[model samples]
Target: MRAIQITEFGGPEVLRVVDLPEPVAQPGQLLVDVAAAGVNYADTHAVEDSYLSKSTLPMVPGGEVVGRTAEGRRVVALTDGGGYAQRALAWEAMAHEVPEEITDGQALALVVQGLTAWHLLRTCARIAPGESVVVHAAAGGTGSLAVQLAKQFGVGRVIATASTKEKRELALELGADVAIEAAPDGAGLKEQLIEANDGNKVDAVLEMTGGPVFDASLAALAPFGRLVTYGMASREEPTAVTAAGLMGRSRAVVGFWLMHCVTRPGMYREPMAELFAMTADGRLKPQVGGVYPLTEAARAHTDLRARRTFGKLLLDPSR
Candidate 1:
């Protein structure tokens, strides 16, 4: 099998294509012929050994794949690693059959990015109907879907922040009520968010970028607002938040990791089924930014980290 291997910790340059023997499945696991692999921001962190969990040497970098079992069932698998390959192994429990209507790339998108967006709004944020929500990086994979899911969940308003005007427009097309520029340093970001929500603070925030964005989003929350931090794409330190400050404003700062949800029964399946249904019915559109051939994994990571792409980026292992 051909796979992207990283023997040393570094940047996208470390993702080198290599040929290795195919993996055999253990009991309760399925061997999948990888068709497409989802590329994520976390994959960047994983390569640098800076993720929430450290990476081991001589490992493949992707976790989500859309492929098939030997039995010919089309499925999406959540692997611990080795997804960026022509073949990978998945726990049967972590795999779901893909619908006939959903493309391989779209199914790959649903596994990590789709479920993360769903959990961010539905599980972590506990967003209420008529509540105002802000989704950062709203034009990216998770954020783009989150904007649509927020509307589907009947939020009163969806405020989207993106770094580019074109991306903001795309967010609006995806159902965000308003879209605003995300200034790099987050200068006046709180005011922009509040203003976008019609002179009021937001009820919940799905924040990924750290540093000033986190600081501003925290400040832009309404009383009793929930701020869920999922990623630190900026690789910068966030402003400190004290309990006293949270208590004074009656605000809460929460952190969510999708892997935690994978540990519980039905936690992963239920929301994933919902996302599948949404995608099937055309309610949820999983934006696919670009698809790279198996050997160009480095380029995919480069484009993603540089913010040069949008939606879900994928690697076509068959290519």
Candidate 2:
């Protein structure tokens, strides 16, 4: 099997394609023939050795994948790592049947991205009907799904922040009530979010961009609202916040890490199944931004990290 191997902790060129032995499954695990592998910011973190619990160098670096088991059942799998390849291993518990309604790429898209979106909205934030939400990176993989889920939650208004006009438009099409270019100060964007909700503070915010934007996201929350921060795509430098931000309005701020949620399926099973049901029912349609051959895994990562693609990027090993 050919896989993308990170021999060094550096640039995209460090991700070299080479023939490696195919992975074999252990008891209670299944091997999937890689059909599609999900590219994520997590991959970037791992390659740079910035992620928590960094791996030894030269390991294949992918955190989530969609493929079949050794028996050839059509299924999806989650991995601790090693998905940028022709074959990978997954715990049986992490495996889920891909609904016929979902394309292979869409299935790949939704599993990690979709599952993260599901856990974030339904569990971490517990979005309420009629409340408003501000979704940061609203055009990316997780944000796109968050917008759709906020609609499903019956949020009366949704404020989306995107990196580009084209991506912002995609957020609107995904169901955000209003979409705007994210502001540099993050203050102007707060005002826009308030006005969009009829001068009401946001009921909840799904934020991934870290830094001053995080401070604004918390400040934008409505009295008694919730703010969930999951990623730091924006802030390379840390930003500080005061507890006063939470005290006055009874506003609650929390952090969400989907990896932590996924590791504890006992916490996520019922809802994940429900998300799959939503996919079957056509209430949730995850976008697969681009599909690249597995051999082009480096290009996929480059495209994703550069923010040139929308929705989920998938690698097709079989292709």
Candidate 3:
């Protein structure tokens, strides 16, 4: 089997293509012939050893894949690891049969970014109809889905922020009520968000980037607003929230990690099923920003880290 391995923690160049013996399915696991694999910021973090969990040496970096099982079932799965290979293993419990209407790349996109977007809006933020919401990185994988889902959930206004003009345009195409440029250091972000929302503070905010962006988002929250922090894509040091700052506004800051939900069977399974159904019916569309051959894993990481790509980046192992 051909796999992309990270023998050391560093940059994209560390992702080396190597030949490894095929892995067999363990009890309760399925050995999948991988078709497409989802590339996420987490994978990049794992390669650089900055992820939430430490990765061992010579580790396969992908966390999600859309593939076929030995029995020929087309499925999208959340792999324990090793998704960036011709063959991978998935726990049967975590695998969902892909609907015929969904493409392999789309199915793979839903595994991580889809679930994260769903939980961020429906569960973590608990957004209600007619409320105003703000989504950062609105043209990226999770952001693209979040923008569309917010509108579907009946949000009165969806404000999105992206680093570039093209990304902002894509966010609008995806259903954001307003799209604005994201400042490099989040300067004036609060005022820009309020201006975009008709001078009103947002009811809910999806904040993944830490540093100045988090600071601005936290300040932009309306009274009783909620902000869900999922990741620190900025790679900046953690921001400290003052209890006093949140007291007067009755605002709340919550943190979310998909790994926690994965441990509880129903938590992951239910929303995933809903997302799949929505995708099948054409309600939810997972954008494929770029697809790279397995050997070009390094280039994928480079594009992702540079924030030069929008939507989900996928790797075709068969290539």
Best by lDDT: 1
Candidate 3 residue pairs in clash (backbone atoms < 3 Å): none
RMSD of every candidate to native, in Å, equals: 0.9, 1.8, 1.0
What's the CA error at residue 179 for candidate 2, in Å? 0.9
lDDT of each: 0.92, 0.80, 0.91
Task: Give RMSD (Å) of candidate 2 vs. truth.
Answer: 1.8
Please, what are the lDDT tens digits per residue for candidate 1 over residues 1-319? 8999999999999999999999988999999988889998999999999999989998888998888899999999899989999999999989998989999878988889889999998888999999999999999999999999999999999999998899999999999999999887889999999999999999999999999899999999999999999999989979658888899899999899999998697789898899999999999999999999989999999999888888999998877
lDDT of 3 by residue, 1-319 (tens): 8999988899998999999999999999999999999999998889988899988998998999888898999999898889999999999988998888889878877889999999999889999999999999999999999999998899999999999999999999999988999786888999999999999888999998898899889898999999999989988754647898899888999999899898796788888889889899889989999999999999999999899999999998977
The TM-scores of all predictions, comma-separated, are 0.98, 0.94, 0.98
lDDT of 1 at 292: 97
- Candidate 3, which segments miss by more than 4 Å at Cα? 238-240
User: Of 1 and 2, which scores higher on TM-score?
Assistant: 1
Pitting candidate 2 against candidate 3, the one with the higher lDDT is 3
The true-versus-predicted C-alpha distance at residue 234 of model 2, in Å, is 2.3
Off by over 4 Å in 1: none
Query: TM-score winner among the candidates?
Result: 1
